[model samples]
Target: MFVGHAVFAFALVAGAAAVRGVDSSRALSLGAVAAAFAAAPDVDMAYALVGVVSAQTTDALSVASQFWQTGNLVHRAMTHSVVLAPVVAVAAALWLRGRRLRRRRELVAAGALLASVVAIAAVVSGGLGLLIMALFVAVAVGIAEGTERLTDLGSRETFSTALVGLVSHPFGDLFTGLPPAMLYPFDATLLADRLSFSVDPTLNLLGAFGLELLTIWLALLVSLSLFGYSLRDAVDGRAALGAGYAVSVLLIPAPTLELSYPFVFSVLAVGMVGAAPRVGIRSRRVELPDRIAALCTGLAAVSIAGFAYTVAYLVA
Candidate 1:
């Protein structure tokens, strides 16, 4: 659920913005803010890099194990909590406050507020917690400041979208590992266990992987809607080409997230079908929508290839 968090956030915010009659560019800008908020929670992963550095190898399985062994120290803690969403949103908004009217009182008030937030982090998770929060807020506010400069969207929209994205993100984590610490900074269990899709380990992992793919499709669909296009327009006969990828089901070993390159590389190659649809003349420029169509078509092909491979592997 790495990118799934941001994908879901983008879909939720951007789709709603389009439905509410906001123009495309602004909606995309707002979507970027939401996506940033959704992604910021994972900044705790910086703690995991220590393991990778120590392991000193690029092997996927080794790196993943090293990552989690260390990341579990604080990965799904305070920032992932719904309780921290508003406080974080407010901190991010402070950066957007127009400062031409800067005064000692206002500056002092801001400083006090930030200091209080820092104190809370120290109490909740200690020194590493402050570092994680610092990195998280920096990334989030950087994106927010960029969004403000690039679009006319105000703090109000940012607040609402931030809440939606940050709050919704933890649910996406439920299938990957233990449910996120949804009530973090406090000791409480929300669900207590990761959701299981099947009794078989491989089947369960496949189900989760497919679920991740669905979120991507959802985000792409929302983008297409804003661009005045449909899924039908993007995916076409060329997608059938992906079926050929199923042959790899026999050629390579089965893949899990720990070692997925064989399956991932093979499936992604199916996306080349998108390049098949080209302008009649090489000299003419390709329109954005056409490029978008190609991308969607590629995704559809990837989906087909993934499904075909999964089924082939299972049945074999």
Candidate 2:
């Protein structure tokens, strides 16, 4: 799921681009909004996790003596429910709207969009768990388009692309110990238990190092492979680099992959999009940054040292 999440990010970026190509800017905005909406399930951990919520709040919430018996409040609760997806989405959109504006009319529009996503997610699943999540996104975006000030994609087009992006999230989550409850109400136990631990240090270092290396290496490879592909060509080279980046991510340890998956993939996806021209094949050749190489080397050194120290401490 670690590597899978990275793919999901890439897919989202691609979907947004696709949305931009066909629809108006406002619809594209809604697509971004949809992407954010799809990420809401993890909000259950908001009060507990450092990233989703905050460690301080999590600590405070779980400070009670009975915390251990609380059945992983964030891990396995309403957040994991398929039935709850719509509820959560609607609530979140409305809450965000409310928080942003005091107007009741604005809240109504936001809530409807959230509801639309729920239907999309369910019908889109069409029995495939992964596809359902994508459906959520498509519907959310499509509904958001209803309120668009600029332009919007036909509901069908938005629906299709959103599905492509939606399914990736659960597919990636599968690699982690916690898979999405894609069919929440029907299937309580979501995700196969192929991997253990949602966190691993070695995997984190590996992902961090591998992603950087592959992306840079692919850039070099394509340029060298082609007659005219140059260092300056940043755009066309990204897909190749993405493939390498994905491979590096897949090689990371299950636990570590889970831990660093979100941040690593997010950064890579955004970087790929922004740096496309610089890294694309259509652009002029440019030198790979020495800083990235140095960072990977440093990460490798630290990992080895940590491993050695852990072993020594254990032996002693």
Candidate 3:
């Protein structure tokens, strides 16, 4: 869901900015900033690499389990907090505001708040955890700095975008595993259960996968619009070829959330058909707009095929 997080954030931030009268191109740039901030909260997953390395297991499932067990120690703690999201947003606003006004006090207060988040992370996780979270804060503030330097957007606008990206990130986890410690450091657990849309584990995994595909498709639609091309124009009828992916339902073992790599890899590989060169076509002008449209169309077709397989699997 890491890439899903970025795509979803881009659609949201860009759409919101466009609604507020920002130019489509500039709004898309703002969306890029939001996407980076949205993925920043996952820095804690870096620790999971440590576990995967330490475990002397060659099996993929064992390695994945090790990674999750270690990652869970800090994955959704301080960094995923709705509480910290606001702190980071306030810090960003103050820093940008202070820089614009040359107010030393506002700058100092912003620095203090940002530092306090790292301190809380150390208390919640541990020593190295502090460094990982500091990276998270650095990314949030750094993106703000980059936005101020690179874009015409003002401090307040940046804060709003950052706030949306950060706050929306943890909610994506609700479908996959343990729900985020939403009210972190407060001893409250408001949303503890995964929104498993079905009772059967395989069906639940498909539902989660379907939700991600839907999210990406929605983002792709908005993105194509921002690029000034309608999706209908961009998509080629050849994308129907993706329906062949359904054959995988018989070839590979049924997948659950924990061991979905085979299904995911096979299904996503269907999108590669979009990249195949057109033979004997005289129009040789290769461009991103056309290519992206083809890619999205192929992905859309494969998602439909995957959903059909899920239904057939459930019926059987």
Global lDDT of each model?
A: 0.77, 0.41, 0.81
* TM-score winner: 3
Q: Candidate 2 vs candidate 3: which has greater lDDT? A: 3
lDDT of 2 by residue, 219-301 (tens): 23322233233333423323333223333333433324324444344334434333322343676576453433333333333
Model 2 weakest 10-residue run by lDDT: 63-72
Colliding residue pairs in candidate 3: none
lDDT by residue (176-225, candidate 3, tens digit) is 98888878767899796888888877888898888888778878877877
Give me the runs in candidate 3 sitting further than 4 Å from their true place. Answer: 59-61, 99-104, 281-289
lDDT accuracy of residue 80 in candidate 1: 89
Runs in model 1 with CA error above 4 Å?
99-114, 256-262, 275-290
Instruction: Report the number of the highest-lDDT candidate.
Output: 3
Instruction: Give the per-residue lDDT of model 1 (tens digit) for 1-316.
Output: 8788999999989988888998998888888788888988888888898888898788876777888889988888877888877776765555555322333553355445546656677888789878887777667667666766776666677677778888988999998777888887778899898898886666676778789889999899888877788778677677888888878877987776445656766787888888674544777865333677678888889888888887887898
Indicate the worst ten consecutive residues by lDDT in candidate 1.
98-107
List candidate 2 stretches off by more than 4 Å: 1-34, 49-72, 76-147, 194-316
